[model samples]
Target chain A: MKKAFLSTGLLLITILILPLFISPFLVYLSTEILVFAIFAMSLGLIMGFGGMPSLGHCALFGLGAYTVAILSEYTANIYLLLGAAILISLCFSIVTGYIAIRNKGVFFLMITLAFTQVLFLITSRMKFWGGNDGYSASVTANFGFGEITSNMGLFYMMGFFFVLSYFLLKLFVNAPAGKVLKGMMENEGRMIALGYNPKTYKMIAYLIAGSMAGLAGGLYIYKTQFVSPALFSVHMGAEVMIMVFIGGLGTVFGPALGAGAFVFLQNYISTMTDRWPLILGLLFIAIVLLKRGGILHLIQFVTTFGLKLFKPSRSRNAPVDKQVKGKEQAS
Target chain B: MIELKEVHSYYGHSHILHGVNLKVNKGQCVALLGRNGAGKTTTIHSIAGLVVPKEGAIAFKDKELIGKTPNHISKAGVGLVPQGRRVFSSLTVKENLLIAERKSTSSEKQWTIEEIYQLFPILKEREENMGNELSGGQQQMLAIGRALLLNPDFLLMDEPSEGLAPVIIEQIKNIILDVKKTGLSMLIVEQNIDLACCVADEVIILNKGEVVWQGLPNELLHNEELLKVHLGV
Candidate 1:
């Protein structure tokens, strides 16, 4: 627990100090990474913890963005936009989750994918929302603070949301409902026999994940200043899944690390090489083939290796050793 | 009390249970004995609502339970210790027990975590261990402890002694007897005739999904020829 707190503190301190040393473009990139990290974390909640693999997760994210885009036209209230985003995304998840969760495994994936595709088609064809070109978000909502027209201000706002969503998700995942989710994932039949309606728990997970995704979507629109039908694309959904897998599926902070790596690769690697996707695919294959636990496993391996090297006599520290071992097994 | 009349169930195109009739009165322990593939597990599944019967009237305390979902049936006071001791493999022993813990609405005393630990002291010792880390006997004990935590009025246990050492089986037999003394009704499916006869107030034999014989446990013990023909013991 001490180690977790220390690491989180160190990470926040680093992120908090980062923009000062970096360029304006890097700050913008950091904001984008933070937003995507939130998105990835949302997907991890369901796919990793709830054991419900969704292919159309982007539907919620897209709906949230569209909500922000459409609402900004009428009002500049950030609270209203965020509220509408969450409400719309939650409602969409309830309908989609009902249909998607009825089917398990690959069928569930397909149903979710189908839902997003339908949404994508609608968004692309609807000229009121600017069709494929999409709509620009011209809102001046201050989020109860000063105007956030500056890049640094927006970056800080994104950072604030990232921290807020991360802690809230962590709390939810450690709650009794989270334990139920883990049990349901391990054995749905056993959960049923134990008098827990598996569907209800699954739906709850979907709603939480969807709402988080909606929040991310709202942030994404603010960062980009635009909302396009492309946000609801199947390719975008697949990319988020890749981000989750690349970071680590079940680990809370893994997805954030994954989003950072993914966005970094997309932004920097693509600039340096034309075959950046090929490089990304190779890296993904390597992770899947060697470390199924994703980047979290790599980080854990390095930390443990460093600890062992520094303290050969640490066997006497049984509690710390056991805690590390427990984390190792969980990943 | 629980009763199943003319329960016919199917697994896809294959018929698994055919007109199976059984009853367990309040405070009674009824053991369902049959050879492998005699549909003993199927009958237990039907009662637990894991397998809904195509044709039957299953009543638990006069309330029809044939079409209810497994969770609904469980909430209605039926606890199931499933075949192969299917405890959640990833969760800790304490978590496994606590996950199934529900408040008992009955006037009877509730089963607390402390009470469970007392009932299975070995479980208390290994409460922090993951479910899959335990030995088969320990897993069986944990599975039973988990079911007991639900504070059910009735329990449907499938093949509790299927895989265990003789010493462990003896321990299980004693545990079943202790549970029976608490006045909770049970329908246990067992291949071990000795264990079945030891704790069961009555025994029912199944042959190809149909109840071929129902009698006292001593009657089953005495009918060696009947056992040889049906159970091939």
Candidate 2:
């Protein structure tokens, strides 16, 4: 636990010092990555812990963004806009999750996808929501304190929220409730036998994941000042899922690292070629084929390898010996 | 404390349990013995609410449990050590125990982790081990420990000796007896006649989803005709 804390602290310090050395464009990109990190981490909650692989997670994301954009026209209260967005997205998840969670595996995936597609059509086709063109928030981003005109200022604000969200999610994952979700994922039948309603826990996870995603969406619109049907696109939904997998399926902060890698790759590759999606696809194939688990597992392997090189070889075999002894004793 | 009256259950079109009636009075242990496909598991599942009965009433402390979900049934103080010791494979032994820990009422004796460790010292030794990493006997002990942590008033054990060696089966039999000493009513389903007769207060035999004979363990063991005709022993 202390090691995790130290590493997280080190990473945060790096993020703090990063903008000073980077260009303004990179600062903005970092802010975007932070926002998507929040989004991906939220999806990770359900996918990794609850083991409910959702295809339409972006529905909640889009709902959050749309809620903020539409609400911005009425009031400039950033708190109200973000809060309403979160609450609305949470409600949307409750409705969708209630129906979607009834089905398992492929059926669940299809239902979520269908729900998002319906929402995408409605937002894009309707005149009130700006149709395909989309709606825009105010250019000057102000959050009660003052206008965040500089890229650094926005990056700092996003970075703060990113850290906050990460800690909040970490707390939830460590809580007894989260442990139950992990158990459910491992064996729903066993969890049921243990006196836990699987659907109830799934819905709880869905609510938290949806609201957090909504918060990311709210932050997203503040950064881009634009909300469009593109936010709810099938591509967006699938991309976030990919982000979760690329980071690490079940780790708390892996999704954030994944988001950074994904956003960075997308931005970097797009600059060189128009067919960036094809390149990205190939890159993903390579990662899946070679890495097997995700970027997080690869990093873990590297770190352990580094440690093994430094430490005596005898210590490495200790756990294995213990496990073998345990087996013998058990038998 | 638990009663099942004329419980008929089905699996799709094929009916499994045919109006099975059984009861486990307070502090009593009933062993359900049957051949394979005789609906022994179906009976256990029906009581645990894993298999919802089509037409009949299952009452725990006189409350209807037929329409209740498995979780609801479990929460109502009925615990299940399911068939094949369905321990959560990804979870550690400690986690499996902790997940099922429910606070007992003031009237009931609370079963703690310490007590569980005392009961199964090997579990304490393998506390950090994952469920899948354990041997069959260890897994069975974990399964029992998990149910005990629920502080359940009644337990439904389905084939606790399903895939264990003779020595392990002997250990499981002793564990069952130990648990029975706690005054928790149990309905144990087993094909192992010796284990069943050893621990159970009364032995009930099922044939084709129907209760064929119900008597003392010694009586059943003594009756060669009933054993040969129904159990193929």
- Provide the clashing-pair count of each candidate structure: 0, 0
The C-alpha TM-scores of every prediction are: 0.91, 0.91
Stretches of candidate 2 exceeding 4 Å from the true structure: A1-11, A20-24, A143-145, A290-292, A315-331
Tens digit of per-residue lDDT, candidate 1, span A64-104: 99999898888888998999999999999999998888888
lDDT (C-alpha) at residue B104 in model 2? 63
Error of 1 at A89 (Å): 1.4
Q: Which residue pairs in model 2 clash with each other? A: none
Model 2 chain B poorest ten-residue lDDT run: B101-110
lDDT of 2 by residue, A1-331 (tens): 4544665677679789999899989998999999999999999999999888888999999999888888888887878888998999999999999998888888888899999999999999988778999987774567778988888998998898888788788877766788899998888887997889989989999999999999999888888989889887889989998888888888888888889999999999999999988987887788788886689998999999999788866535569878788779989
lDDT of each: 0.89, 0.89
- List where candidate 1 sits over 4 angstroms from the true fold: A1-26, A305-331
